[model samples]
Target: MVLAVKGTEQEELQSRDRAPQSATVSPTTGFFFTSPYRSLSTQGCFAKITQPAADGDNLQGAFQQGVQQAFAQARQAGVTNPVLCGAIPFDTRQPSALFIPQQTQWFERQAFMASVKPTLAALPTIVRQSELPKQTQFMQMVADAVQVTGGEQLEKVVLSRLLDIETSKQIDPHALMMRIIAQNPQGFHFHVPLNEGALVGASPELLLRMCGSQFHSNPLAGSARREADPLQDRQAGERLLVSSKDRHEHQIVTAGMRQVLHGRCRHLHIPAVPELLSTPTLWHLSTPIDGEVADRAENALSLACLLHPTPALCGTPMLAARELIAQLEPFERGLFGGIVGWCDAEGNGEWVVTIRCGTVKANQVRLFAGAGIVPDSSPQAEWHETGTKLSTMLRAFGLQG
Candidate 1:
């Protein structure tokens, strides 16, 4: 049998003689990438998906078609289960970067796959701003409105903005990480750099994860730190789970996900309760929703797109809050708060929301963070909460606190 790749110039002529067929590429031999920026433009020859559906119309059908197309491309290229991937823009104002493999490889004997890592810039890091008397007055104005409306019941509504960082050609994502290390060194650090886009974060929230149909989604809501001891950590988690304010916030996210997955998945189980997860400096109210798909009909991207901008990331009233963000947030989210992961033609993949993340271009970069505001939320506290969340992404870059 003749083997070939589909994306590069040389493969085009080579593939003209081959017959088309559907094939499954193993997890070990597909395309892979780690994007850090959410806005840069990227291209892939085969299996590249286009813009997402504005609404959930024909999305299932479209996703199915995409899967078929990917298979077709794979067959012609003589590779089984070619690694396929692309970006879905959420927070950025610009079009997403989509990447398919530029070349295909035969997997007969190699145990490890190889990919090129792109140069990237690190986002500027900032320490917690000292609270000033006037800042409280400003937050008070926002707080009063929230309380009057019952939105103030939320444990902590975080709020943050994008900051600009200088960039240069001799880019060193690792060196830049060292600078951040001087600040916030403790967190779940992650780095994914690609020609199309990039993402770096220490996220506190888990949008959704599927492990052989036993799905797990630990939605983080409230944030507090364990008191400087192991027992204290457990106590902090327990306190967070029981806090009415925290529960209210957790419910909004869990319920929103439930609504989004309604009729699409089966055996959906949501405990009539929440659990507490304590981090180094804060405690969060978290809940895990488990379920299986009635029909393995949807791919991870399609399902994830349906649940984008969850109440945890957006607001309880999703449509309204999205509009508010459009009006209030100065910049677009781009890939921020969007879903990122890998899947195949079967629609099975893992996607995580791009929270606690930033964007990097040639030399410049922008980091973003936000908080949910409700009636009980304190603006000052919310601001601090956002700082905590941003630390996730910053710490990944070794940003100093």
Candidate 2:
């Protein structure tokens, strides 16, 4: 792969024939970022920033500084709209990484067309699959929410489980990403290379998208698994729409987002009701919020920082719910519930919640999924919801629960 700066000669970033050994690449080295909606994808690195320990309160400021530095470096190479992409940990205090690609390439429809040609023989076979938070433990965690908090202090908390898939050989990152994109072309698809592995997924939720002073956010909360039978699938979606528990959960996320955007936006419009959105594996309660920001300085990343870890991902009464998540979840949500996307120096970008995602290291792929727990949430139901969610990525790997 050759990466050429706008005004410079093409430079080889990697050999086109070389294949990525793992799906998740180490962010410390170099990486690429792309979205299904955009025509352009970035590759290689011009400048990179690593926040091994980021302060929760100052994450926005940190991102701003990193972006400025990256743009400065990109300007030196005479590139405009250079893309910065990476993942932030679920806990903002943990380390995060972002990269500014040295070169950008435009694709007809998909950014990974050439890389997807790897034969099925090169694809890894799943040797074993294990759930991180076993069914019993996950159910107990859901029980703990009501038992410990009495359902008041913590209204909702999203608890996630990991699915560890051990493969016969290292999975090819590009091929895996292509499969995901092909399966769900309308979703926000991303691939970020880390040092040892990579992060890849197709997300249906948009955390935030900024184009100049206008912005949009589509938050999805309530979910139901898609059924094989057409009649069953329609019934499942209709059931989700009217279920009081699901409606309440969806309301919490919409209300929380409105509160966050109140001051930043000059005018905001949020529908009174949520519409149903469908992905290959699940149906979601989705609300599209649109607004115009008065603060020209606010930019996309800053807005993302302010609204991230939404009730959709974290839960209501933010801090309290975060504490509960820490007490319950056994794994560090390294980039699973975080944000993924790109932004330019002008603050124009789109970021989506890192759900329906997996981390690949060596021959092991760990997929993550979560369910929103409320006062009336059923333990068994939540467990099944997560399984339904994991099916999206699992299917991409040619595996089924």
Candidate 3:
């Protein structure tokens, strides 16, 4: 559904900007969450519970307790069907967050209508785009991976690179979000506020979604860049389907996820083969896995916790891949490759893989993308893959390659 932002200039500003208009009120943190699925869009927060040092091993238990506590608080405020929305970092040990929205709004499918066109007009023009890891350095890292393990210790590892774009003016998070929504109508769109900036993106991968005892996950891997020509685009997708390397990479993720869900789900159904899933910029091999939860009490967040940082995002031999990532990558991957979405008192909600996203603060935006590395992976090819992924956000910012 098209969202018509309130026309007043004050309404266009950050939520913090409108707080002063109210009578001396205690400060409260707010969050925004949405998905291509219209039923999932939500904004505003009545009360929020934060666990700054949540235990990684006990994440499920902690999340359950936190949700119950937040629901209790929401009940006292006469709120019903209350939901929690936020993100979990790639590193489970890192501090993560979820917010219980007090007051929220949901939208239906339609064009976003506004008296004034919500254009990218307010965002600063892109002045420069720089890669965090130079091409040569990234190539060497890939070579090191191939040489160190001799192709046996690690089957695949996802190596990521950052693209930092400096702009001419401060970025308006809302405007950026609007533009993203306009461009990628079918994506899981989100705009989450951070202490210093906002995390925004339109992700095509669903990490997990639960409703009652049923659960579903669509994990994507093995990407091929899209082409403008219809014939070439079809050929690209066909190539991805039969590529031995791409198929192997895709298989590892599917098998890992199935293994993780084995004891937790019943009547699990995973396709023997993957199908093609396409975004505007790339085509990916995707598998849809579904099953009924063995324990009805296990909520969406807990299930997401279990499956997050899948081989699709990290790599096989998860611990080894993570260690390699730490030693090789230059910057910290805060919330990227994480999970984002909402869950309610009931164990029903949707969580999506936070890829094709970026962090926007003031006059700068840092975008991230990763390519899975295997025994025969090419560093130059991986670098190009990241470039293709970054284009999803770059195009949204009204910037071109």
Which 10-residue window of candidate 2 scores lowest in summed lDDT?
Answer: 1-10
Which regions of candidate 3 are displaced past 4 Å? Answer: 1-30, 36-38, 41-43, 52-60, 110-122
Sorting all predicted structures by TM-score, with the top scorer first, yields: 2, 3, 1
Query: What TM-score do all the candidates reach, one by one?
Result: 0.71, 0.87, 0.87
Quick one: how many clashes does candidate 3 have?
8
Backbone clash numbers for all candidates listed: 47, 11, 8
lDDT of 2 at 280: 86
Residue 248, model 3, lDDT: 91
Candidates' lDDT values, in order? 0.52, 0.76, 0.75
Tens-digit per-residue lDDT, 164-232, candidate 2: 999998777767776777777677777777766888888899988899999999999999988899999
Off by over 4 Å in 1: 1-6, 9-47, 53-64, 91-94, 102-160, 167-170, 174-197, 211-214, 226-235, 278-281, 396-399
**Clashing residue pairs in candidate 3 (N, C-alpha, C atoms within 3 angstroms):** 1-108, 1-109, 1-110, 2-110, 2-111, 2-112, 45-102, 46-102
What are the root-mean-square deviations of the candidates from the true structure over C-alphas? 8.1, 5.6, 6.8
C-alpha displacement of 265 in model 3, angstroms? Answer: 0.8
- Output the lDDT of residue 108, model 3: 40
Writing each residue's lDDT as its tens digit, candidate 1 over 1-401 gives 11223354434422212312223222212232222211111123453444343442235464445555655666565544444454456642244443344333322111111221222345444333332223454366446436534643332223346555554342355454433332323322334444433565545555555545555566776676446678877777777667776677777778878887877787888877877665545677777777886666555555666676677777756656666556545466766766555554445555566666666555556677666666667777776666666565455444533
Ranking by lDDT: 2, 3, 1
